[model samples]
Target chain A: MPRLDWEIYEMIERNPFFKHIGFELVNSSEEEILLKLSIKTDLLNTNKTLHGGVHASMLDTVQSIALRSLYQCPVTAMNLDVHYFAPANTGHLFARAKLLQKGYKMAVLEAEIIDENTTLIAKGTGTYKIVRNA
Target chain B: MKLPVTRSTFFEYLGFNSTKTDTFHLDLPLQAILLQDDGTVHPGVFSTMLDISMGATASLETNSFATTIHLNVSFFDLSPKENYHAKTNIVNIEGKVITAEGIVYGQDGAVAAKAIGMFKASPIKQ
Candidate 1:
């Protein structure tokens, strides 16, 4: 792992929201990144299943992490599209993100959330704007 | 509208509060626990807030439980802020399917994010 990668990892580890959600970095590389979250009582929705927001949150984080792994500069999320496939009520959930397009001032990424059984729970794609420091 | 009695634990965890109005409006007080590394509010925070508020709107409109089928959100700003407010309204309802739109405002009242979502409404059991 490069020094920048370690920096990005440390940054993620220090994020308060990341800690609040109890997300763990399962794997990371320039090619892709994976994050895991264990379903807890506090993460459930009115349906007693994992909240759709959790899926969106995790997908957003994974894609942003994937982007930062490739480019160390600061980036901000510009857009996100999420599709929910099925409900997740138990066990751990995994999210994997891959960069789809890296542009001069913007980047696009896609991610999928799956259960331990590899059942797809949700899918998302995001566009982020690269900040050049105004 | 008769809302579901079951409390959404995740929504509580996010610390969102609804206004007294009949519409689906929510406010999230800025907390250190919701900030990103750069001190700006996390994008996930916006998405989660919008998702819940918008879905809640759809549910309230139909008087049934709602599940998100698809959600699209656009972020216009992510500057460090004090708090956020989100409001949602039903766009259309056809049978069991509902479409809604929501907007999130930053502390300064600027548009922070916009979202549109589709939800499947399931009749709440008596």
Candidate 2:
């Protein structure tokens, strides 16, 4: 992965949903990207924990951030597998993502969602297809 | 022997709608906020829909609340319009774990995605 600076991360943080969902980029590099999100009632499920969809969404976005910083291109998710280790209902949640592998057409990335105490809340692995820059 | 919509703000934000008429089904208007740069429905949105649908199916099938343990989705197509549909059914239920499968259909009636989710059936805490 090519070295990337902060500008690309800033550009992606401008997404409305990312903002609406309250995702903060804690750190960004070519190797990995770290994001933090506040737990809000709106982001909760019926059981009062961070909703499954939100976790999946954040994983998708964070994994893409890792790939985008390197490929400088938009990516689409082909497959996503998420495992919930525990419920995220309080405090802050952090998502850390890194590229597992990349090829000519597809890239595999992995991410983990952790609580403020660094407890693993959820884990995700996804395959993204890199599109050519327009 | 039916459950309510199981209110959730995230579902409302995504414009998710559920119905009960012999079978449970889900529908959502492809909102702009849920679209990727290429204008297709984001896979995360699909995941959320699948999660909700499967949860609803588990609730209806087992008549209890469920917490999602794991979910896996595969994308087969993409939508080019402003709407999508999802239908789910319980594939298996063994005591406390329920497994469900669902399909997402694009507006053009093509299979856009499919997902399988595992949920833990339990009583609502608090």
TM-score of chain A by itself in each prediction: 0.93, 0.90
Clashing pairs in 1: none
Worst 10 residues of 1 chain A by lDDT: A1-10
- List-wise, what DockQ does each model earn? 0.78, 0.65
Tell me the tens digit of each residue's lDDT in model 1 across A1-134: 12336778788878999999999998775445779999998998888888888888999898887777777777889999999999998899999987789898999988999999999999999999887663
Candidate 1 lDDT, tens digit per residue, B1-126? Answer: 533334589988988877534676688888898889888888888999898888888887888989999999998887767888998978999999999999999878899999999999997654
The candidate that wins on lDDT is 1
Across B47-72, the per-residue lDDT of candidate 2 in tens digits comes to 99889988887877877888899999
Instruction: Write out fnat for all predictions, comma-separated.
Output: 0.89, 0.66
Q: Which candidate number has the best TM-score?
A: 1
Q: Which stretch of 10 consecutive residues in model 2 chain A shows the poorest summed lDDT? A: A7-16
Per-candidate TM-score against the hidden true structure? 0.93, 0.92
The TM-score measured for candidate 2 stands at 0.92
